[model samples]
Target chain A: MGGDLGPRATVEGTARALQSQSRLSACVFGPRALLAAEVDALPADLRVAAERLTLCDAPRVIDQAMKPSQALRAPRDSSLAMMLASIADGQADAGVSAGNTGALMALARRALGTVAGIPRPAISTAVPTRAGGRCYLLDLGANVEASADRLVDFALMGAVMARRVDGLVAPRVALLNIGVEGTKGSASVREADALLREFAGLDYRGFIEGDGIYSGQVDVVVCDGFVGNAVLKASEGLARMLMERVQATFEAHWSSRLVGLLARPALRRLKRELDPVRYNGASLLGLNGIVVKSHGGADAAGFGCAVGRAMQEVDQALPRHLARELDYWRRANASVACGRGVSGADPRRMDADNPQR
Target chain B: MGGDLGPRATVEGTARALQSQSRLSACVFGPRALLAAEVDALPADLRVAAERLTLCDAPRVIDQAMKPSQALRAPRDSSLAMMLASIADGQADAGVSAGNTGALMALARRALGTVAGIPRPAISTAVPTRAGGRCYLLDLGANVEASADRLVDFALMGAVMARRVDGLVAPRVALLNIGVEGTKGSASVREADALLREFAGLDYRGFIEGDGIYSGQVDVVVCDGFVGNAVLKASEGLARMLMERVQATFEAHWSSRLVGLLARPALRRLKRELDPVRYNGASLLGLNGIVVKSHGGADAAGFGCAVGRAMQEVDQALPRHLARELDYWRRANASVACGRGVSGADPRRMDADNPQR
Candidate 1:
């Protein structure tokens, strides 16, 4: 439905998700023949329930430089388009893909539509923290540049996801900046900080330094997509480099190998705890329906996890909750604006009548 | 003779350097009384030779909103001014400070002057890689925005330092970017990549991904100061967060404590291997003399290590080597310019002969 490896990984993933989650049902959308072939190839015990797998015959698009119309039109004849159509038609609650990120984003924007008042949809990823810990970071690579308003929306969406999905309550949200003070970052970050401060439902924790991302200091971290993308990539790079070094060190000598043997259990536990596949899926927030982007390099297992995550979002009615929150933000901002008698002033502030300022 | 922590840390560090390397001498610049007190406090075995600790009593200008003139114009009695004067007057081979980085950079610029043909100086930090690992990343936090030309200079300076100090024969250099391809970055990165491709002396590895920073894949990583500063802080934050988690995990339960005991040797080895104090110094590159900045939060141990690092730079004759290389770059660029008959065109390109259509 997505790209070259789409049908196979998606089929296997669907099978695994069915077996692991008893209540889950999957409606796979793609060329019916290919989907059937992939499902049929699965081991007998792992075969997906035929009734649960709904196949839509749509052609796939693969080139990166293809014109948007051509790319969008091609996917229409393939599984991804059918999946979006299913969501739009209320036949499917959510859709998940391991395809071109840009294409997926475009299709979601075109079909699912944005939450009212939200400027742009953000992609949020859960990164492994130290000691079996993890936190959700938003706008991983969705929009390259974001307005202060978009950042505020990201904060609200990220916090809601963390609480509902990760079970963190009244999540502490921090705006990522160069420093922790009010005047520390670019004009955008400072403005975002001000906007965040006035947000009614958020547990705003002021600014967080870059290092705080992995410190487990806050549950939800927000930033413009450009900085967020760079930071996420950097963290991924560091983890890979560390793992490589550990491997090389263990393989260096007999003594180190013996030491490695003693540390094998801990190392394996650490590896599983930090495995990207276990946490490889990113949810595109502010969309009308659930859509998760699995890592492009994800194998069968990773793809399976993304499917499970997508199912969870659908069952939990995350989009409904997000819409309600967006309503709350709009009403609150509107009331504040009315009180101030200023049409364009930011409402995320201490009201003049409330002497706190 | 820099900031409040200068005299004590500098004296102690100098003493350590002298004790470790008998070939070195240090000139302590500060209020003579303070320098004498610090010198007296050093252990007899670690104390420098009398002839080595030449004190220059210089007064200081201190104010919260200190004016540039107030900060810059040393009352002929200021320790910082005297220290720079010593370097300028040939009374010292290099200047080292544990003072305000801004003030030190300004003083150095005013006194020793920038390397000929270089626009601005860069600050480079040698980050520890895994075993047999070391990489120099620049402008840690010095210049927020750097031109392509300045980045080339940083690469050259970093390569020289890595070779002379870290012992890389022909250090592989890489431009730090979002992706490891020529076309995958902002306008500045793409331009810098093109410029760097022309420098023949360096073992130019193409764009390096973020994770490659600690992979020891390359010896020198170049970037403008803004991104560099963010990356550096994030890494430091992650390391600290990990250390804290390790401690907390060890202390969580009786069984974990027992496991901690069993893992003590390995943990200790890792801590020692990753200790920041052992590698928490940054060198100010492209200056007339060597100036290393210790972390502002450095304690005695950290400061001691910074001193050792400064001594290493002196031993390596880093300043002279950098000057020689810069002169070579200038001459090569100038000749290429002459050949192309375009006075200001970039000389780094080999395609100068083929004018654009």
Candidate 2:
């Protein structure tokens, strides 16, 4: 009832995901009647797998167009909020939804709160690269007005996620700016550059331009939400237009159409490799729980990818590892973290003297 | 002497351009000895046509890495400065350089000044679209921190360029923002949208996102320099990456390689259609004289396109038309123009009592 495809896509995606991960289980949150029909339609193998799933009866739906504030006031019986509540109450290991991004972020923040030293969570996802690889890009639209301090925190959390989630020991982290030159970006970006350089456990690679987003030279790219959202959407729009043009050109004349038939396999491979749906899941990094946001318009396979991502995070104990890492960094760098004009200064730095962090 | 390929590419491109435009002539600015050698190697027809060429002996060259401020202090004996001076003195109808962008913009502004009501000129160019067409995009790197009023000025200037240069009457104009939603971008974008709406002569289409730049949905896209530069470079980088990947995939397998052989003609057509060099010239808009900046690394064919663009602008009397239009807009909407706090506020509106524009 939450996504564009409603509960059907979510339930079917869950069934598909269950085939890959035997240990995983789900608590489906949607209107009970609709959820049951979707579940009943699952194949025999998945029907047996459905024995592991719990259907939490949530009748009301949160529409995609609802503003975050308006969605926040939605009945607790709504699927999205209830799904998040399950994670908050420790009844579920992780939560995944294909709901509206802003409303989802707002609800996730209110339900789960921030991890220690993180003022807010950032929306992050992996972007495919020409090198036949991918890089983690963060703050996609979470914090529109991210402070220098928040950017530094994103670098720390993003690096941790890359190391834990992507299996890299030292991820090459970069701050996204208008130009690669040191003098190119806003004051906050320059300051974030300085702050990242001071972090000992992180591998900060200075600045990367918008074009460098897909260069595959770095593992993690960080920026304020405004720039990130613009780059991601713009890249998607351009890629779609180029592909459409190529298809049109290939079909224009009989000669080209003959060649197009020959090139079909290679073209299909290219399309699959660059499909945005393959990288549909956006992690709400810096949150206290494991949460993944699927694209609202994503199909079953795309939403399954998001579900698979959530399953992976739960297996890795991502939130626990992140909390431990944040506590360790603040304790190690308490002196340098103090006296900065930066907002959302590390709480763990203050608590370091108390020995509770 | 200026671009990456030095005097050879510039000289050769000029020779090629001379072949197409019978009425055209050139004043070559470089080391007299090196310049003569290149010209001497031109085709027989072009050599005789050299009678129309003037070789100015400027011994110094501005390096691509030179800072704009440093380049400003470069000797008057340098090729870049000399070329611009030739335009300023009306010896050349327009100037084209495959030199450093920052340096070119700085010198163009200093030598030609802004048009009557424009505070600063914007760096603008046409980007190819899937519609088998191109649209103008501006402030590629000119004004990084544009105010709302400056944005309004950009809209006016961009519209004039689309109309006069692109030959479109009432060219649809839009302000590039993070989102199309009226509340998405910073305060300046919203205000610029409002200002654009009041201009009856212009076809204001409202806001477009970064992805819309190449959508061919609007005739002109205006943005602050930072976002514009990032988007332009990012698009270039992605296009290059995708093309490289396609080539790699085609060559990776025997089946694909065989298909690639059959697809060669179609592929070549696609490459030619998307070639960045074909759209290489970037106009320095809102300036009193026509100044075109070619890619510093452009080769003969690419530089030739820039030369062709400059020639087109000259034939059309672009700057004169822009000045006339700006004067008319301010005079026609004197009351509304006065009450606006937008920067580059129409000075003509302040002088409404004066008879002359």
Best by TM-score: 2
Q: For all the predictions, what are the DockQ values?
A: 0.31, 0.57
lDDT tens digits, residues B1-357, model 2?
768888888888888787777799988898999999999887686776666778999999888778778888988878889988988888888899988777888888888776646878888999876566777887887887788878877877888878877788778888887666676667788888887778777788988877787788888888878777767776877887777867776777899899888777777788888888899889998888888888877898898899999988887888776776776676566654765433354555533421211
lDDT of 2 by residue, A82-191 (tens): 98898888888789998777778888889887666577799899987766678888888777767888887788888888899889889999998766777667789888
Candidate 1 RMSD to the real structure: 7.0
lDDT of each: 0.70, 0.79
Query: Which ranges in model 2 have alpha carbons more than 4 Å from their true place?
Result: A2-4, A40-53, A327-336, A340-357, B40-51, B331-336, B339-357
Model 2 native-contact share: 0.53
Compared with the true structure, what per-residue lDDT tens digits does model 1 show for residues B74-143? 4655666677778777777666666666566667777776654455678888777644577888877567
lDDT accuracy of residue A212 in candidate 1: 81
Candidate 1 residue-wise lDDT, A1-357, digit = tens: 554476788888777877888777778766578877887787777854544665666655444444435546663655566677788777777788887676677777788777544556899998766535677888876765567767777888988888777777788899887557574456777888887787776799998877888887788888766567667766766666555555555545666566566555555655665678899789999887789998776777888889878876776677766766555565676643233233343333312211110
Q: What TM-scores do the predictions have?
A: 0.80, 0.91
Highest lDDT against the true fold, candidate: 2
CA lDDT, candidate 1, residue A157: 92
